[model samples]
Target chain A: MSPADPIQVHLVRECAQRTKYVIDLPEPLSLQAYQELADNLPGILSSVFLPSGDVLLQIKLLEKEGSITGSTNSATLHVLLTKEGHGRLLEHILQELRNQ
Target chain B: MIDIREKVQFVPHLDCGSLILGGEPHVIHCHYYNHFLQTSIEDADGIYPAEQVLVGTAQEIGHSQFRKLFQEKGIQDERERKSFVEVVYSLLGMGKVSLENVSAEGGEISTPYEHYAYTYAATFPPRPKGKRGVAYFSQGYLAGAIEAICDLPLGSMGSRQTACLTQGDPAVSWEFFRLREPLPLQPSVGEGRYQTASLPQPPHTRVPFQAIRDAVLGLPLGPDPETGLIEAFDVVLTRLPGNYYALISERHFQHMLSAIGPDVIPLVLDMLVESGHVCAFNTLGGIMCSAEWDAVVRPYLDNPADWLYGIVALMPALGWGIVEPLTYPSSHSWTVSLHNWYETTAIAALPNGHTLTYSPFAEGIMNGILALVYQAGIAEKRLTFDGELYGSLFRTGRTYQSTFHQSRLQGAPTDVVEGHVAR
Candidate 1:
């Protein structure tokens, strides 16, 4: 959690089923950590950096639905956030984005 | 504020599974059923003078309901009557309205939040031109309320949805005027034919049906004070009169069969069933994914297939009637029987309903439960509810299918639907 990294979480919507977080990456991922991130706390609904550099990394957390999620790419890694504890982190991230 | 949610008490006939609201037989239904049934009704627009049946049916029911409420509650003042109608409209999750400008002479009112206009708009892509809009339910209800308030007869007032949110309009607006000639209409067949039996307790499942049912019943799914829309389960919802859905659906199906000929039958039936599919994905999926489900029902889940049992066990609370699981051989397959089901029971009671081979709506619901629960692994948090995911699960190769072994609407003892992965 370095201030130098400055990850941007654009939008955060809490819906009936899941929490949707839209973020813009300041820098691309290593592509090596795809499997590791896919195996954790929040499910990656759609994490695409695309052949073009456009990014849409929507991460969702459904409690008790278990922790395995996300899709991999030969291209640059799409998202690099492990937002396990959904409540305050989401609110804090949104507040940070607002402050920015 | 009228606060009709407080004024109109819901007396639940727990035995028969009937919910009586404002002296009308009301049942809680999600947007999926509402939009689909409306599509089926509006499908017969060309040949049948469908407006009479579509809007008129709502008018008849609204007229009856408002009249009863007026007499029972002794609602005499015109201003109060107007407030009561608008409040009840929002209370049912149909969205808000402004009745200040409406009167016996022609007048117009508008809303940015009519449920039919908003949800129905989302169901389809915005047209480049000519969106007739989908707020007829609210349209006719308001029209009928106007009639009752003005002390006019049932068919004395006429209304039109001049512009709606579905049409890409900023607000949904309707114009009401005294009809030059009152349309011929019939009063609603109140609380149509109902039969009941004690719910079955199969020895195989551990999900507590009663507690979940009670929990759902207790949720105060009322409208927001500002917006006046019931937003829950990730979708706009309504506690509608079930008979209105039944009559409109049956009339459309019968008319399509007779006037349009046998060629349209398959398409019509498919659309009817697809409505149920929509319900399962949105309504049922929303329920399964919600925090309330986590607190109330999710802990009871042992096997993935138990999700199916947990869902059906409490559907009677929605007043759709009792659902009993006959067997759950595997996650890929199962069989469940519906007894005294709402759609079938209503159709069996209505005169024109004899022609339906199966309950199109219910069968679609069966298909969705399998497509979602077992195939899509909804319980495992894999469900994303996007178009691509929906296609892969419901339309692509090796999709789940449902077969009706018995149909109670056709006089069988009980309606049985068996689901499994397609061969």
Candidate 2:
């Protein structure tokens, strides 16, 4: 894919009870790229990769009861990504985005 | 009189608690008689008996060693012998010693001892604080060394540490007096034998003040492994009084934190945060604050972003290990993880075992700095620990999370704060 081309990975909820998210990739990733992405992701967000080769991105999102109520609370985003999905994310950030 | 500038060679080796110096191995250790007496001695009356026995025994041992070393050198001249004794004292890391007046006939010497080791060691205990010139082991060592060199009879001399650094004196001064009668011994308790306990050792490596200062000064001002901004903080911390940076040994730092206790940690944090505010205002003032935010901290000011990068860059200056950032399921709030934190490590190093204590002072300091830089009030702060790494976060604030939370509530406002925008 080109640097300007958008590579969007779909976020799939892993479990209904938890805030876990998993991103499935269209292609399998090389071991080298997966490792590189794993090493570098800490610079962006606090995350860990599961033994199943899925990356978990943890984020805190602000949640409000309703649009009209306006009272807000905090929530965590447990995002998981497949090896290929992580590789694409890293490529888009480190390579393509930097070129722009 | 021997010249004061003569250099002496010393070989040192650490053997258990003692720091043995010189070729023949003259052993010297910073003994904690006070700690032993306080913890082990049962009755108030038993204290003096225990102290006398312990000090006398140590003195006798020191005297024999000094006699052996002196005789081996075969220095007949009195002044030369005294000078040699001074060198030995200095070589043992016992601080500098200079004799002022020596009276051979009177059997006394007036000397000034600067940076005596015992005085430095005494400052660690939070209670039963030290009095001026109460370094028993040091006083005993000095007397023994003098008596050995002078060839005086055993127990013929008594020395008093007149001035002490613990009492804010620049140096400890000693006045040695000739004793007409033999030393008096008090009755001993528990089968006429005294038991001594050792002081707790520091967990982290103790770097000399000069070494730390030099290392900090030698750091490159340009972008290096860590950011120069953090290096600047290192310089400031090193320059604080009483070797504040080096004095903060891992064990001692932990002791101080545990002493504060968990219930008091939040209050201490709040106080530190307030202090940070006052300090920030005094140093940077209100005007230059915006210009001082580094690249790492600038971007996070507007959006709800992870602050791990900034914390990681700043950890070394704070004397911490690599921090792992952790996130909770509820609230997009993130907390920095403290791995092998000074307190945690120190508590683990305790010999008698220790109860778990948590202090959010580190988190408070970070939050305070962030609040000051972003020019925002802290809204919600929470601290948690999971056996290891202590995790903490500020959920609501105008700076990182607060600004992001506010924007999210107001339909994702595009405009950033004026301070962050200026950057």
Candidate 3:
């Protein structure tokens, strides 16, 4: 996938009343792969926020036969915060992903 | 095959909240620890003098983690942000725990096995979404779950000298109220009767006294002081079962009075004996007026304005019962009745003063009493002077029986003293 291309990503709330942030991957992603990435997402994202503002991002990965693979990965970014004070939280995620 | 791995349901109600520690999401289980945290942390500093240090430490840690998580996650997206925060809020529903300053770091901290413990049985808020749903979690949720569980830290140390070590933060209020000291002895007078030293009357104080007096006149006085006498107000503050702190009104004193019958008196006692405070007072006898002591303790005990827990054992009788598996249960050592009985009974008049009697119903009351007292002295290895005196006085044959009593066996009495008649 080219970085310039518009990656298809949807920011959806599974429950109207709940505040959980869910990003649907176009292809299947295995439970373990999703969890491993999700577990580190907070810390990685916390470390990557830019001085300018909040980080906006998401990743798409393949889930084949209910198993996750890095090659199947895709990405999206969201400006979750306006001020850099807390905005880097999202940036940290992108930075960690880039580092990986 | 029943696939347990499938995405079942995420019940928002089941979520207690989450604690973000080190950027890790720690999910709080509502059923497990929500109410516990609410009571622990609602306070500004999470300070409490409970025998449980874990609870205090957990509260402080949880609070800090919570504040940080929110500060870091300034969720701007309306939909996604709500979901994230709802999870956080549910986790906060878990109880709080904190600790006193490290008491000699690196040393082993005490646990429940070695100290007094307390817990609030609370009711929780229902699921925010529709009622029907189960909570599902992936391994990613474990870190948060563990963080939440870590909130209630258990400590075994109790500050009392007889206790091994103080376990909990001593600042938190407890359901049990103690008097400052033991009842001061009224000066002894001629004859067996107590001189009943006159107490200083309530001064012609202004304001509050007038308010109380006016309130009293509005109500009908009962037959006797014991019945109608509104001695003093006992204020009880307790964290209720429904995740709230309830302040019992003054009217609730009637319920307390009924629970711990009128026989219990508020005598002038030492602060340690009275133990009205949550912490243990030093055991020392200090001269103070009895009425003054009673007045000091009356407000906390008598006023219903005090906070009371829904599950608190207010009455001594309600406190009695062998909690199952008696060994590890918290109620095992609950001596409410025994303590109350000891307080009401005069130790000096008993066959063995100071030495507590374990058995009450013996066939030969006197013989059993003497034998038990005698045995106690020998067991303590104090059979020299006072011990010897007790042994001799309580021996089977040496005890004096009143003439014309049931079996006043006299003359060449082969055996059978009053204490050993049935034994």
Best by lDDT: 1
Q: What is the DockQ of each candidate?
A: 0.04, 0.01, 0.01
lDDT of 2 by residue, B101-141 (tens): 65533333333343222333333432233543445555666
Off by over 4 Å in 2: A1-100, B1-46, B105-132, B168-170, B184-423
Interface RMSD of each: 15.8, 21.1, 31.5
TM-score per candidate: 0.78, 0.32, 0.17
Per model, how many backbone clashes are there?
0, 6, 112
**Candidate 3: share of reference interface contacts reproduced:** 0.00
Which is better, 2 or 3, measured by lDDT?
Answer: 2
Where's the lowest-lDDT run of ten residues in candidate 2 chain B? B187-196
Model 2, residue B302: C-alpha shift (Å): 41
lDDT of the candidates, in the order given: 0.68, 0.33, 0.21
For every candidate, C-alpha RMSD to the true structure in Å:
10.4, 23.0, 31.6
Q: How well does each candidate reproduce the native contacts, as fnat?
A: 0.02, 0.00, 0.00
Per-residue C-alpha lDDT of model 3 across residues B149-201, encoded as one tens digit per residue: 23212122112211111223222221111124422112111011101111111
Candidate 1 or 3, higher DockQ?
1
Residues A17-78 of candidate 3: C-alpha lDDT, one tens digit per residue: 11111122344333344445656653121211211222212232222101111222222222
Question: Considering every candidate listed, which one attains the maximal DockQ?
Answer: 1
Ranking, lDDT, top scorer first: 1, 2, 3
